[model samples]
Target chain A: MRDTYQEQLDELASGLADMCDDVARAMARATTALLEADLQLAEQVISEDIKIDDVRAAAEHRAFGLLALQAPVATDLRVVVAAIHGAGDIERMGDLALHVAQAARRRHPQTVLPDEVKSYFAEMGRVGVELAEKAGRVIRTRDLDAANELEADDDAVDDIHQHMFTVLMDRNWTHGVSAAVDVALLARFYERYADHAVAVARRIVYVVTGQMPGPLAV
Target chain B: MRDTYQEQLDELASGLADMCDDVARAMARATTALLEADLQLAEQVISEDIKIDDVRAAAEHRAFGLLALQAPVATDLRVVVAAIHGAGDIERMGDLALHVAQAARRRHPQTVLPDEVKSYFAEMGRVGVELAEKAGRVIRTRDLDAANELEADDDAVDDIHQHMFTVLMDRNWTHGVSAAVDVALLARFYERYADHAVAVARRIVYVVTGQMPGPLAV
Candidate 1:
């Protein structure tokens, strides 16, 4: 029974890693769709979000089942609980990715990003994908070193977010109100996506250290 | 022993309700701070968010305890799990409220919203508080009817959100990109706060009816 319980916990961790992999792909594709104006890719990313949800639901089911049947205590209990909460954060990261895809789809045939901030978004997208991939690694390995790196990764996203604002607020910015709104919203989506990724990493760190990480700086 | 378990479950529910109450108050105060540009009120809301976090941590601890000790099954298991997840959503709602407060505080003596959309934000503030209060009732009563009402309540928030966008997109909007960015971000904060409240209600409805609601229309 103890061996079976340990196996189930391993499965829960793997399921979360798989969900993170899916989310990472979605973020990558969503950014590509945004930059290249690929509506098909955007739609694909949006539709596949359901798969991430399914993975999360399964993880929650397994964790709850373990709680009900095994009644894991101490470290085991913490792992199961963190699995449930970490799955939630991952699921939300998927939602944020979908938002990015939808924004790309809604602005189809026209680039959602104004030309001025195009390169900035490209850099943001790169860092966003890197963060999601790193998040997957942290969940799979629970390496405190890798988990701690997410903060710096998210800080890069924030810097770009701040830069996006600076560009919008610049006197040279000629984009109309509509484009400005689009740009602002897009930057926010990316920034928030990074935040959720960091939150997931922090949850893993908490499970390892038993020191509760405070809320992400939203 | 069964009676003791039942009492623990009751405590979990009460703790969650108390957390909801604190979050509701934070949202209300954050909105007032924004509307009045009351830095003190904003700062108070910002600081009080930590208290909400503490409430959530305690609630999670209680729920985890029940899960480990009593090994609740069936409906009991579902309720405990929901408490954990629901507390998370409520805590996030508090974070969103904190974001609102931070926006107001950052703007300091200068008002964040442009003059044209002032009344619109006022309406949003009123609706935000009403939604949070109603959310508390839905959680406390577990009334499917009350829970279902949150979707329509969120619709009201979405309407204001759309109106804000329309105003921003209007050619008549003379506010520079800075004010426009501020307004866009503020609108998003309220919109997401409403979405989280609706999500909490949906979780209750799920526990009651077992019908899963799809993602929020972000």
Candidate 2:
């Protein structure tokens, strides 16, 4: 019976890891939709919302079942809680990707942007995607260092966010108000994506430190 | 020893409850500042950001502590977890208040709509404030019906949000590009305020139902 219980726990963790992989991949696909202007991909993300939601529910049920039967103590309990929070955060990130896809539908075809702005978004998207990947890695390995690294990346994201705001406001550009709005929201989506990555990092800290460490500003 | 432990738990609950009260009031005050263009109130909301941050940290710590030591089983465990989730949502709501207040600084001394708009705003504000107030009541009373009521009230907020958007987009309005930005963002603040209230309501449902509920329509 004890061996069976141990195997069950292992299975639960494996299942959770798989679900995180799917979430990370789903997010990457949504961003792909944005950059490629692919309606099929947007529809894919929208449909996958329920799938992510299902994984979250399954993970929670597994966690609760383990706790109910085995009565997980201390760090194990925290692990369950951390997984729950991480699950919820990633689901929200998925929703953001869907929002970006929806907004992209309204945007002018062919990613027309001033060269600098285009580069800014490319860099931001690259980092945001990297952070999502890193979050999945941290979940799999519980690598404290990888999570900490994501914290430093948020600063770069914030710098881009601030710069984009300046471009939106500067009178010299005569940036169309609608274009400004779209870019502003997109920049914001990236920055917020970065911030949520930081949050995942902080959540990892909570697991390691047994308390939530300070915000990822450091 | 039992008394001391219980006291600690009670104190933590009250501190969290206080944060809830602060957030609800801050949201109501933001609407007042927007309508009245009261810069002083706006400044107050902005300044309170750090204090709100402090409240959130304190609340999360207390919740974590309760979890770590008590290992609260079943529904009690759900309540503390719900508190953490609700606290995070309300904190964002408080941040949205600042957004509204900041937007107010850019608006004209008075809104240009006919007298009917103000009446609409008044009714909308009342519903929003009531919905938010009920979030706290759900916390204290653990009343699922009140939680459902709050979710229902959010529909009225959505109604007002749509109306405001229509007014802003109307060709007859003399509002310029900047005003349009303020209107869009202000509407966002209200929509998000209502969103947080619905989130709290959802949490309340989970606390009572022992299963997370479906998303409430805006």
Candidate 3:
């Protein structure tokens, strides 16, 4: 039974890690859709939101299943709880992307992306995907160093986020309300993406060290 | 040791429950301050927000302490998790009130609540206080029916909130942007208050059933 429980926990982690990967990809794709004014991509993301929700519900059910059936103890309990939390964070990130996509759709088709800010968004997208992959790697290896590294990557995302804000606040773009809303919503998406990724890293830290790493860890 | 653990859990729940009672009152007081434009009352609520924060932190710490010490299983674990979630929800309710109090202070030294929406704010305030009180009662008694009542209360609050949109959308007022900001911000506070109260009820359901409740239970 213990072996079966351990296997269940491992399988659940694997599923969650894959779901996180897809969540990250969806966010990146949504950003592309927004920037490129691709109506199809935005609509796709809106539809894909159900996938995120499905994964979130599945993660919780799997965790509770392990809890009720195996009465998992020790590391196994931590694994189940961490999976639940990670799934929740990932789902929130999906919601953030949905918000951004909606704002973009409301703006109609697409607005031209600012050059520096576009680069920043692209870099953010890359970092987000990287974090998702690293989260999966940490789960596979239970590697403290891998988890710690993912935590550190959050700083790079934040740095670019600050740059994005600076671009928005710069006196250069004094145009329309749509521009302001688009920029604000995009910033929210990036900030929340970084936040959710860091949360996964924090859960990994908790699993190993039994303490949540604070902002200082970043 | 097991008996002592149970004793501590009860004591912690009682103490934290008292803190929740305090938060519910502060939220009510803040709502009253908004409806009456009572600067003094608003100021009082603002000052008391620190006490609410103190209680929130202490409740979280106490729950975490119990979790770490007892390493409780099944029902006990659910109880602690619910308490932690309930504490955070109450804390957010306090935050929404503080936002209102800050607005009241800005309107300052004068009764600035628009006469047109005074009744609306009053009803909102009333519903918010009543719902919060019911949530507290449900927590204390672990009564599912009382907890279920919160969902109905939330619907009532939502109805008032939807009506607020019609008030804002009314072209008759011909108010400027500042009035629009005030109206929107006020609606947000009421909407958020109802949300947190519903969260408390949801936690009650989680505790009683050892499973997450459906949307109706909220």
Native contact recovery (fnat) for each candidate is 0.73, 0.06, 0.02
As a whole number from 0 to 100, the lDDT of residue B178 in candidate 1 is: 82
Give the Å error, residue B83, model 2: 2.2
Best by TM-score: 1
Ranking by TM-score: 1, 2, 3
Q: Enumerate clash totals for all models, in the order shown.
A: 0, 0, 0
Cα lDDT of model 1 by residue, B78-135, tens digit = 8888899888888988998999999989998877777778888888777877777777
- Pairwise lDDT winner, candidates 1 and 3: 1
Better of 1 and 2 by DockQ: 1
Report lDDT (Cα) of residue B28, candidate 3. 76
Greater TM-score among 1 and 3 belongs to 1
lDDT of 2 by residue, A1-218 (tens): 35476676666655655655665566577666666766677678777777777776777677666655666656676676676666666666666666676765545365434445777887787787788778777766778888789877888889998898777666675645555555766777777777776776677678777867674331
RMSD values for the candidates in order, in angstroms, are: 2.3, 3.8, 5.4
For residues A40-87, write the lDDT of model 3, one tens digit per residue.
777888888888888877877777667656666556666766776687
Error of 1 at B121 (Å): 1.8
Rank the candidate models, highest lDDT first.
1, 3, 2
Model 3, B3-99: lDDT tens digits are 5888877866676567667767877788777767788888988998888777876776676566555677677777776676677677767777787
In candidate 2, position A27 carries an lDDT of 59
**Shift of residue B164 alpha carbon in model 1, Å:** 1.5
